[model samples]
Target: MSYLIKPAGYQALLDLQQTEMGIKRIKDFFQQNLSSELKLRRVTAPLFVLKGMGINDDLNGVERAVNFPIKDMQDASAEIVHSLAKWKRLTLADYYINEGYGIYTDMNAIRADEELGNLHSLYVDQWDWERVMTPKDRNVEFLKKVVNRIYSAMVRTEYLVYEAFPVITPVLPEEITFLHAEELLQRYPGLTAKEREDSAAKEFGAVFIIGIGCKLSSGEPHDGRAPDYDDWITETENGYRGLNGDLIVWNPVLQRSVELSSMGIRVDREALLEQLRISGQESRQELYFHKRLLAGELPQSIGGGIGQSRLCMFYLRKGHIGEIQAAIWPQEMRLEAEKNGMPLI
Candidate 1:
């Protein structure tokens, strides 16, 4: 079921040794740029949390978390985090972080249910970050401002990477274009959601599509978003809606749209209850995290994860994500990549 492709004339921009060094350079440079740009401090994060704590991210509200029972704590279960989407917000409150400041962590996760593909594997790594914000900051304008800052950091990282390894030419645009999901749907009414993204990314070079979770005019969402996080359904000013979106860039080597990050303004109490109701997840209201959030115990915040391997693949000009990160791939995929001179890590 993997969507395999052998990009014509594709080749790794860096060899095995150079790739290893490049990864460190990229990770270090990007993290520094990101932290400085967003005023974020590095923090340590947990690999797993106690089951039933409502701290684990229920991505798409269906994918299961890798869970097991703690031997000494009878009947106590632990689940590997899918993402720090919820945990980061809780941490901001726990650390007593004030508004205008935040924290970022090197988040590692395992998504056992992830479909194997050129862009996906069971292993996941990202830079997860969250910041405290006032109620007045949770709007479309602020969301756009944050998105631009992240994009700037990405651009700066690209420049540094190319400077260190001149062999890899920069492919990112000077500025990323912004588009609404509804606008994209209207432009390509005949195309499916993925196809629409591909079309937009190709046209714009880089694009951020807003209003991801809510039902569009076509009676379906541009993409599925968990209700407990990203405020994708809230109505904001200036005819803008949904304070969350994904940052996508057209990968020239793969000839496809690659999503590097999914971020947005976190939901407030009202938006949380409303989004949960819309997604028919009202039962989550009884969960500990949800209950605490509804009771105004957590901080108002904005956060998201920037995929480590995805960025590496894109910047390294590799056709498949496996070229950047070590992961299991189907035998056929391995043969295909080998045939094209693209080796799996």
Candidate 2:
């Protein structure tokens, strides 16, 4: 079953026109800032890739992609991409993008299996970006540096929002705190994974949790990750077991932590084989995309998706993601939001 949160005493901060203008302002400023900060070029991306090619991301290794048969093409099936995680890496090789430069796209997707909630939606929109890197750059320190650059872009965008919408004050910290998932589990041994995130974000205002997807001392993984893309199995220099993580911030309005992004270094030959073996999906290595990676045909890169509506919700101080994006909501959900004075767009 799906879940929803209705913040008490919630009220729309901006009218329809004002909200539209605010979204535009935020998108414009942040897109420019992010591209410049990461040295990325805007590119067109595919909404769907041919099925059975292993070109699409299998998010969490469970959610099913929306698929259909195309008649004109011999009834070949096409799967709507869950995210551009794998596709972006292939694009890097196809375009021969030099090291240190990358591509970013406005990735739109439909998560048919998604659970409706305060932030969850069937429709997903994000800035899916990837940058080429050398094997030497696949370390915790380099990942932290890239994360800081992204955080700086967000900070500048927050200041811009404050200048325009004085009512929405800037709340993001000057710097985001970085902590490993194991460290977090140790600090809050009694709390669940989500609870730990809330506690850390509340304390630091913003935080980046490193070493996700791998099992900690508790014997269960902090979170599940697909075995193909993110090198979550690799041991880091800091003695952690993951090379990727998520950046989250405490949303004062929602009184909960909202994850802004998840990224990591792409799995190299060694990492991929091991992760596949551990996940018990070694047969995937024979797939086309996997074969290319195994043959060293793709570039070693770092990539992730940053939600567009989530960012807008943070800057606009909206209580629910539906307020920032137009998507079909359950009748009861809509009525409850409306009754609580939380306008859904």
Candidate 3:
């Protein structure tokens, strides 16, 4: 069953009409700020890729993709993209993007297997971005630097949103704290991974928990990340591991941690092989995308997806993701949201 959290004395900060305007404003403002800060150029991305091409994100290696046969082409099937993690890397090479430069796209996807809840939705919309980088740049310091840039963009966008919609106060901290997953595990040994995230976010206001996807000292990953994209198994010069992580914040509306992005440095050939072996997904090395990576055909890059609607929901202090995006919801959830005066778009 999906979980729900209803904050006490919660109400819509902006009415439906105003919320519509606020969504557009936030999207515009954030994208501009992000592109400027990251040296990214906006680009067009595909909604679906041909099946058997191994282009779709196999999120957790379990969630199924929405696929169908193309009538005009015999034996050809197209699958709706879950995210552009792998595709973006190929695009960098195709566009001949140089190091320090990249591209960002407004990506819309369908997660058919997603469970319904205040934070979870079947429809996913995010700013998917990728940037080329030199081998020397693939380190924890570079990852943290890029993360701080993104965080700065978010803080700037928050101020802009608050100025336009005064009722929606800003709750984000001026600077976000960084914590490693293993440290969090040590700090809260009795808590589950999600519970640890909640404790850290509540205490720090905003945090970036590093070292995801790889098994911690406890013999389980702090969170699940796809093996192909993030180089989670590699350790840095300081003995810290994982080149990727999630940006989590304390959401007052839900009284829980809200993850706004999942990103990391794209895996190189060695890291990819190691991660595949560790995740027991070595068979994927035969897939078209995986083969190209193994052959060193794709560019070295860092990339991630920032949820557009989730950011709006958090910045606007909405109770649910559906309030900022048009998406299907369960009847019971709709009724519950209505009873709580929470608007779902």
lDDT of 1 by residue, 240-335 (tens): 469899999999988889999999999999999999898888999999889989999999999999999999888888888888889888898898
Q: Which stretches of model 3 miss by more than 4 angstroms?
A: none
Please list the Cα RMSD from the true structure of every candidate, rounded to 1 decimal place: 1.1, 0.8, 1.0
Error of 3 at 21 (Å): 1.0
Model 1's TM-score against the true structure: 0.97
* lDDT (0 to 1) per candidate: 0.90, 0.92, 0.90
Which prediction has the highest TM-score against the true structure? Answer: 2
Candidate 1, residue 105: Cα displacement in angstroms equals: 0.4
Candidate 1 ranges with C-alpha deviation above 4 Å: none
Off by over 4 Å in 2: none
Q: In model 3, which range of ten residues has the least summed lDDT?
A: 1-10
Q: Provide the lDDT at 307 for model 3.
A: 96
What is model 1's C-alpha RMSD?
Answer: 1.1
